[model samples]
Structure formats: C-alpha cells, structure tokens
Target chain A: MIKKVVASVQEAVQDIFDGSTIMVGGFGGSGLPEALICALRDHGARNLTIVANNVGGVQYGVGILIANRQVRKVICSFPIGRRQAKLQDTFWEQYRAGALEVELVPQGTLAERIRAGGAGIAAFYTPTGAGTGAAQAREVRSFGGRECLLELALKADFALVKAHKADRMGNLVYRKAMRNFNIMMATAANVTIAEVYEVVEAGTLGAELITTPGIYVDRVVEVKVERRWQG
Target chain B: MQATESVADSRLTERQIAWKVARVLEEGWYVNLGIGIPLHIVNYIPDDREVILHSENGILGMGTRPPVGEEDPDLVNAGKEPVTLRPGGCFFSQADSFAMVRGGHIDVAVMGALQVSERGDLANWMIPGHELGNIGGAMDLAAGARQVWVAMEHCTKDGKPKILKHCTYPLTAPDCVKMIFTDIAVIQITDAAPLLLETAPGWNPQDVQKLTEPKLLFTKPVKVMDLTGAPANK
Candidate 1:
C-alpha cells in the first residue's frame, strides 16, 4: 500500500534535482504552496523551468526562486507588472540580461495546455491566440468559421500546490479561488505533493467535495503555518 | 449647436468614467473586468444588481475592494491588489478559469485600450519600443468574450486621438470592440462603421469629431447618456 502522508515538506521535495521542469500552482497569492516552495528553495535545486500565471512580485511567490537564481526559464502569459507601466521584476531583469529564457503563452492557451497534459491528451487547437504574436510559428487552421492555433500539452516533473483541506487518503478540497492550476497540475506532474492546512480523517470528508482525488496525489504534508480562511 | 458647458469645462475623472461603465452592466451577468480604469467599476456596480465579477486569476463572484484593515492576504485580484469575494463566489485553477473565458462563459468583458479602430480592432497590450511586452489575459478575453467594451479617455494624455481610422500600433484583437465609452462620447461599432450613439453632455457632434481620427457618423437620432441614473446593480 502506498502511504500518502509525509512528515515534512523537505522529505516530499527531496527528489527534485537540477534541470527539473516544475509546475508551481497559484495565481498571485491565492493558492500558492508556500511551505513547499520554501523547501525547494532551501533544497538548493537549480536550473529550473517554472510554469505559472505570474512569476510573482518582488518578495513573494516564484520571485523568491528567481531571486535565488534557481530558475533558468519560465513559460507564462503575464510577466511581473503592468504592461504599459513596465515591471522592475527580477525575472524581467534576468531575461533582459540574457540570463533567462521566456516563452509567452496566452492565458487560456496556457491553461488548456496544462489541462491537456493532465488529461492525457496529446495536443489541441484553440482560437484564443489565432492571429496575435502568441500564434507565431504555430499551425494555423480554420475551423467552423474561426481561425485557431495548435497548442501542445505541458507536463512537469513535480507539482507543488496548496489545498484548504485533505483527508489521510489524500483526497483534497481547495478553499475559494485559491485552487488556480493546483487541481490540473496534480495529474500532470510525475509526482504531486500537496501542502494542506489540515488533514482530516478519511471518512470525515465527503468524497464529492474533493477537488483532486487521491489517485492523482502522491503525497500530502500539513503546513505548519495554516493559511487564513474567510477572515 | 447648443453645446452643453460641462463637456467643455472639464475632463471626466477616472471614478466618473467607471461609474458610467457600471451603468451598462446588466443584472445577473457574469462580467470580467480588465485592469486599469475598468478596475474602478467594482466600486460603482449598483447595489441592486447581482453582477458576478470574475478575475483572470481564477476567482468568480468577486466583490469590491475590501477596506484596508479587513483584507485577506490570500485573496487578490488579477492585478494582485487585495479584494473580497462575494457570497457564493468560488475559486478554481488557472485551467478552469481560462476555460470559462475561451469557452465563452463570460457575458461581457470591459477592458482598457490604447487605441480602437473604426473597424473595432483593439490595440491595448503593447507599444513600439517598450522594455518588456506581456499581454496578460486581454487577448483571451478579447478573442473569446461575447461582448467586448472599451473604457478609455477620449484622447491620450498628450491630446492624441485614440479612436482612429486604423491603428498604427500592434493590434491586441481585431474587430473585437462592440461599444466604446470615452469621456466625450459613446460610440457603437456596427458592420458598416462607427455610429455616434451619444455625445458627452455639453459637447456637440463636431466637438467629438475634432478629437476623433476616423470620420464619425452623426446619426440623426442620438442620446446624451445621463450618468446620474442608478447603476445597473442598483
């Protein structure tokens, strides 16, 4: 029998190595896995490619990894700041200095790509980036009176996510809007580790409310500092 | 031409423009408000209507900005500013959120634009010679939204016309804008061309024409929208 519970974030993240492609879930501050990220940072894994909505601001989220020079590339839609106003982001500065590489994907396209990876679908077509620079060099096809670009699936070696609650079985239920990318990311990664606020007894949590089933979750760890809820 | 004095006297404040945009929102409609001026629409959504606000970050049923003292550190908008979620509002992953957008679940999308063409093309994301260019969610919303509305000033801060015959800047989305609410007028884009639906109070058709690059059709029947009326939510 495969046990899902882990004693510490560092133990769950011990396998991550240099040059690993990782999917870090969350949008801004909503569903970020803070403890696992800190563990990865402390674990000293380098040369990583991170995929998420934003790389994060100056002192938060994935920005810490960039600040530590752990990341080598990023695949995302939005960069750090307001497009018109410009961002003083560490990642942007790194990219400008030729120390990093970036592949810009449209928001919907990025989501579908990750979803496709989790669902075992090879590739799909989307109308979201038909003619913009996002569609650059991709196959263009006309379907049902609309033009679309072919987008490929995105998979990762490890996925780290935050969930509001979990059972000992690893069935998860996320709180509010913080579930961004965590659910899909669970199935897409080779190993998925969840940092939950609390671990309830298996039968105590209803099966229907679980966002990511235990089959998709490899390990679960309780975060020492539980996230605030509905304050 | 009896030009109303107010249009000539002052520029519409950002909050005022947001209030005007709020009036156009329909009750029970799921709306995605883009960054910048459209963000202010949250404060002005009428209390009477139950318009659901969505963020590209995966939150729907978003409420107005919370007071300084009561902010939940975990909750924020696409802009990363602290916000409150409304009753029955829930969060999902980035994939699910974009599914709502690309799947056309959004009823209306209000966004800010740098320039809009007579053909309703939008150029909002990038300009030539910028340091870094990232579009965020505007491209998806513009391409997938049921109805696209632009909320911007009549002219650039340097007094350049934004509504043009053709956008010289890089395009964000082609032929996407259905209506434009500028400080000086409300214009509707149809298959034929831009129709002058209404002029700002105290401004005449000619005054609007002078500031607009494309030739605007001064249709005989036009109304000056009264912003003082209750917002859609109210």
Candidate 2:
C-alpha cells in the first residue's frame, strides 16, 4: 500500500531550503496550516517568498514569519488589514519601512494565475484591471473591443494547504469557504504538503467526495488544530 | 461624508441608501456586494426577492453575519468577516468562484466608489495619495458583472464633489457604472449623460446639481426618493 503520510509537520517541511517560494493557504483566518507555518518559522529558512490572500494579523501565522524576518516578499491581494488594524500589523510596518517587497495582484487574477500554473498554461489575458494602474508595464490586447491584460502563471516550490480530511494516498477534501486557495495551490506547487485533520485509509474517502486527487498531493500530515475565530 | 444634523435630516442615512439599492435586486439574481455600504445591502433585500449573494472568497448564497458565539472561522466572506451560509449554499475554490464572476454569471455587482466619471468610469480600489490601495476583487466585478451599480456618498467630506466629468483617481474599470445611489440623489448613467432619477425629500435637482461636478440631466419628472421604512423626517 502506498502511503504519502509524513510522520510530523517539521519533518514534512525540513527539506525546504532558503529562498523557496511557498504558497501559504488561508484567506484571512480560515484554512491556515498553522502547525506547518510554525514549523517553517522554526526551520529558520531565510529570504522566503509567500503567496497568500491576506497578510495574517500581527504575530499570527504569516505575520510571525514576517516578524522573524524570514519572509523576503509577499504576493497577495490585500496586504494591509482594515483601517483600524493597519497600524498594528507587521506587514504594514515592514512595508512602510521598505523592509519587505510586495507584488499586489487583483484577487481573481491571482487565483486564475495559480490555476494556470497548475494546468501548464503559460499565460492568459484577463479583462480585470485592463484600464487601471494594474495594467501599467503589462501587455494589453483588445478582444471583441474589450482590452485585456496578459497575466503570467505562478508556480511555487511548496504549498501548505489545510484540509478537513485526506486519505493515506493523499486524496484531499476541503470544507466550506476554507477551500479558497488551497485547491489550486495544491496543484501549483512542486511539493504540496497537506495538513489535514484526519487521514483515512486509501479508498475510504468516497471517490466522488474527493476534490483533490492523490496524484497532485505529495505529502500529508495530520495536524489537529481547532478553528479559532479571527475576530 | 459626515453631515451635520441639519444636512443629515435631508440626506439618506447609510441604512436608507442601502435599502434603496436593495430595491433594485431581482428575484433569483446572483449578486456580488463590494465592501462597505454595499455589504449592508444584504440586510435590506426585498422580502419577495431571493437574491443569491456571492462572495469572491468562494461562497455563494451567503447570508448575513453570524450571530455572536456562532462565528466559524472557516466560513467568511471576501471581507474576511464571519458570515452565515443560507440554505442551499455551496463552496468552491477561488478559481471557480472567479469563473462564476468573470463568466458573466453574476447578474449585478454593487460597489462603493471614491469617484465616478460622467461617462461611468469607476475609481474605488485605490486612492492617489495612498501607496497603491488594495485591489481585491473590485476589478473583476467591475469588468465582468452584467450591470454595475455604485453606492456611495454624493460628495466628499468638506463638500467636495465625487461625481465628475473625469475621475482624477486611478480607474477601477472604464464606463462600468450603470446606476449610482447617493445620499442625496439617485442617478442612472446613460451613454450620453447621467440622468437625475430621484432626489431626497428635502432636496431638489438644482441642490443636487450644485454638489455634483458634472452636468446633470433631469427627467421629465424627477420623483421624490422613496425612503420607505426610513426614520420619520424630523
């Protein structure tokens, strides 16, 4: 029987070298592989690139890594928190200080880019941000009289995804809105490490219920962490 | 815009403006609400309309904010605020979510605007002084939604016009706004010009035109805004 289950979160991320591009899965507070992130912070890898939807709150998942001076850059949709929370967020402070670099992508474009990366599509034109500042320094072509900006695919060295359940063979299923970026990030990375709540025997998870086929997942580790409300 | 007590009496409150926008929703329509005043629209949706709310974070059929103590971290709207899921609600990946939006499946996208050009150009995602504001999903919604409506204050604080002949801020999308609901007036954007549809009870076309930078066209009969269920006039 083939098993992709790893022994521990630390061991799963131990081989990640410095300057690795990692796709951290979470939109705000949900679906974050906190254990793996903590392990990555402890692993002390330097000059990392993180792609996420939001810059996590101060001293939180991605924030902790930024606080540790481990992250070199962040590519995300919304980098700062709400108006009141911006002053306290580490990414905002570091960004204001020019200590970190960022590439802001419109949320939908970011998602499509990851999907394109996984599907082996080189690049595609999207109507989003066609006339905005996001179109600056980018190629734009008119289709049916509507201009579209060309966006390139994005792939990472590793992906840390949180899942509700996984099989020994690494087939994964996600829950609720937490599935946001995890599904595409799972396939868009060279090494996809899934932090699941439960790992069942192969063939135990119904084939129809599995959203991510085992072929895309390279490693699985069970990390039991309760959902903590972000608010 | 922060209105003084006298001005507030004549203008629609945030809730009232949201209620007016809610009146525009059609039954069975798929609607996406941008952050801010647009998010409040879900609370005022018509009882007869069953509008399916879409959050770019991958939820469709989104309900209002969860009751206290029932908040689930995993169930959040695009704003990252905990929201409940209505019956028949479903979740998908962000890619699939954007496909629903970019594919023209969404019927209406209600957004908040910093400035709107007379030609219906939108500039809400970023401010000129702020170092490149967050784009989030505004661009996709502005570009792909079948119809775009803006819900915002008519003018800036200290009485500066927000509706202009041309947007000075960065554009979110060009010529996308179909309708605009402001505290003082309801306007519809046409190919030729913006037509004044209705005005608040205490205000008239001339008063609204004074606060607006662009030229306004009046309908044959500009109706008084229907502020149903709004607080009784002082």
iRMS per model, in Å, is 2.8, 1.1
Compared with the true structure, what per-residue lDDT tens digits does model 2 show for residues A1-231? 788999999999999999999999888777888889999988999899999987776456677788788888989888776643633556666778887898989899999999999999999999999888878879999999889999999999999999989998899998888799999999999999999988988878899999999899999999877676758
Q: State which candidate has the highest TM-score.
A: 2
Distance from true location, Cα of A39 in model 2, Å:
1.7
- Evaluate residue A86 in candidate 2 and report its C-alpha lDDT on the 0 to 100 scale: 35
Q: What is the lDDT of residue B171 in candidate 1?
A: 77
Quality of candidate 1 docking, DockQ: 0.52
* List of clashing residue pairs for candidate 2: none
lDDT of 2 by residue, B58-140 (tens): 99999989888889989988777889898999999999989988999999999999999999999998878787478899998
Residue B36 error for model 1, in Å? 1.3
Candidate 2 - CAPRI tier? high
